[model samples]
Target: MLDRAGYDRYLAAFNARDYDGVADFYVDPPHMEFFGIVITSRQELKDFYAWLHDNVEENVRVLNFAASETCTAIDAIVRITAKKDLTRAALDAKGATGFFPITAGVVQEIRQFIFYTTRGGRIEKVECALPPMALETV
Candidate 1:
């Protein structure tokens, strides 16, 4: 089960971009699914988050969250700003920069739903659902 204090700690670690700290909340062989891509290991998740942090600065505002015995769901407004040049290929995968030019340093907002499953007080699975890229400003 996820308590408020535990969730707050996780949020703090994520907001701080502390990959290791965030990983500490997960159990071994943690699984994460984002945009249909599955990450099957804790180390891989940490690495992916590190890469994301390096490429973009992100801020998350939690609109609401609900917790059960084994699962927690969060609704959040996420803002991501490119810190450096994003490759054409990267933008293409996101289905952005095709119709509208999304150059580097552009800020985008996304409404996201994140679901977490916990076991023995450690997160065991995470699934993230996001809408299409809604460029707030480019």
Candidate 2:
């Protein structure tokens, strides 16, 4: 097994919104996650983080996360809770109020499943399965 303590520190840094700390986890080519999009490459990853930090107002606060590194893959189940400051700056440019919500406290308790393919000790790629969406079927 990998050093659980070290891994915990890594995870804690991520939960703390320490982008640089999370950046350190990537060695060779890095993978970037922007909402539902993925971009690979160092410079692209940096740009992705910059945009994410600038535009996304939500924070990923991990309630709990447990990860296991197998011979060829890493599996993790993370419980994440989030709060978003939904701003209307973009909408305001088009003349719209900042106040609109179907209900208060839109916080979501989501279970995220992350699977990673590994080469040597570094993670190569990741696949994620998130909680179901709230939209009704047509």
- Candidate with maximal lDDT: 1
How many clashing residue pairs appear in each of the predictions shown? Answer: 0, 0
For 1-138, candidate 2 gives per-residue lDDT tens digits of 223454566567666767666665665686634235565865655555554444333333344445456322223433322233434554244232322221223443434555445455455565655546522211
lDDT of the candidates, in the order given: 0.77, 0.46
Error of 1 at 136 (Å): 3.8
Q: How do all models score by TM-score?
A: 0.83, 0.53
Clashing pairs in 1: none
lDDT of 1 by residue, 54-92 (tens): 778888888888988899888888887878767767755
Worst 10 residues of 2 by lDDT: 94-103
Where does candidate 1 stray beyond 4 Å?
91-102, 131-135
